[model samples]
Each structure stands twice: as structure tokens, then as C-alpha cells.
Target: MPNKNTHYKVKNLHGTSKDRYSKKKCECDNWLAHWRNNTKSQRTTCAVLECARKATVGAHVICVDGRMSNEWYIVPFCKYHNHYEKKDEYFLDSRVHLIPVYKLDGCKRG
Candidate 1:
């Protein structure tokens, strides 16, 4: 059995075209800076309904429609949901609920 105290680390997807990391700076450093410098309280639970585990990461939801106006929504998520939530195949045997993000608000568009 997995220890409850074990913290999960998000790994950069291998052999993929996505740039999960930056060559100029550490992604974790940037995330930590954002995580620490913020005055708002961090979310303590996964945003998925009924999930009670602590949110270990901020999962960004990309806008699927062009009409939505290029927006990236970020939500608190646990390791399991954050990992499989984006993979469409996970829905084949599961009823996953996706929360939509509509505006960037204070965040900048890249």
C-alpha cells in the first residue's frame, strides 16, 4: 500500500511535443514563486465534487472553443485527478466531471 504521507511529483511528459519545462529557468521555481508569493490561501481540496484529498497542484484548464477567448483556468487538484483528468481515455470507464475556466483574470496569456 502506498503511504499517505508520500508526496507525489508531477513529471514532465516524455517524448511529447509539449514544452513542460523551460530551458532558461526551473519550472518548479516559477511555480514555487507563484505558490509562495501569493497572498491568497491555497486550496486544500481537489475541486472535483466529493473528493476530499488535499490539492497538491494547480491544474490549468485550457479553453476548447475559439469563441471562449483564449483563457486558461487554474484549479486545485489532487495527484490522481490531475494526472488522468486530461486523458480522454479515462472517461471510457469513468464519469469524470470537468470544470470550465472562462477568464484569465489576473494571469497573463502566453
Candidate 2:
């Protein structure tokens, strides 16, 4: 049987998150709207890149499949960071690279 107390883990299956930004495309118009209200500006703390989005932690699609990552929330990446990723370069997208990559313990998981 499933852990009844852990039902919180299944909440984000259909893009049902507190913030819609997590499901938005990389270059969407509303991309930075949520963070504008946040005090962090665009600072990120994830291991993916040293950049920052409207969010410190971002909802990332998995490379293994067209699915959102069940374990990691890519964070702190600046707009330049996503460009590096689309180019398939080794500079960005480094897991907990030169900077500290702390995992978000409370982020909704798929």
C-alpha cells in the first residue's frame, strides 16, 4: 500500500503546481513574472547552472525521456544558461558544478 501520509508526493502530475512558471517553456513571455515579486531577483541554488531564472529552482524536463525530473529542480540559471543548454555545450548544465547545488526539499515532485 502507498504511504497515506506521503500523498503530497503525487500532487504535481498534471502540471498542477503552485506556480505556473514551472511548466512554462524556456522562453515564454510569462517566464519571469513570478520571480519579479520574489525578493531573490534571479539568484539560483540548483546544480544545473550558475544562472538565475525568475526562480532559483526550475522545473526541468529529463533527458532520458520527455518527462519532468522526479528528483531534481534545475535552478539559479540565467537566460544565458539556457542558451548554453540548447547549444549542447559543456559549460552550463553542470550538476552542482563550481557553485553549490543544493536540492529543494519542499518542491513538488512528479
Best by TM-score: 1
Model 1 regions more than 4 Å off: 1-39, 63-70, 84-110
lDDT of 2: 0.30
Q: Each prediction's TM-score against the native?
A: 0.41, 0.26
List clash counts for every candidate, in order: 0, 8
Q: What is the lDDT of residue 110 in candidate 1?
A: 40
Model 2 residue 6 lDDT score: 20
For each of the candidates, the C-alpha root-mean-square deviation to the true structure, in angstroms, is 11.1, 13.0
Model 2 ranges off by over 4 Å:
1-73, 91-105, 108-110
Model 1 C-alpha lDDT per residue in residues 15-42, reported as the tens digit of each score: 2213552221223233322332231444
Model 2: which residue pairs collide?
44-76, 47-96, 51-76, 51-77, 51-78, 52-76, 52-77, 52-78
> Per-residue lDDT for 19-57 in model 2, tens only?
753443333223232222222333443223333433333
Highest lDDT: which candidate? 1
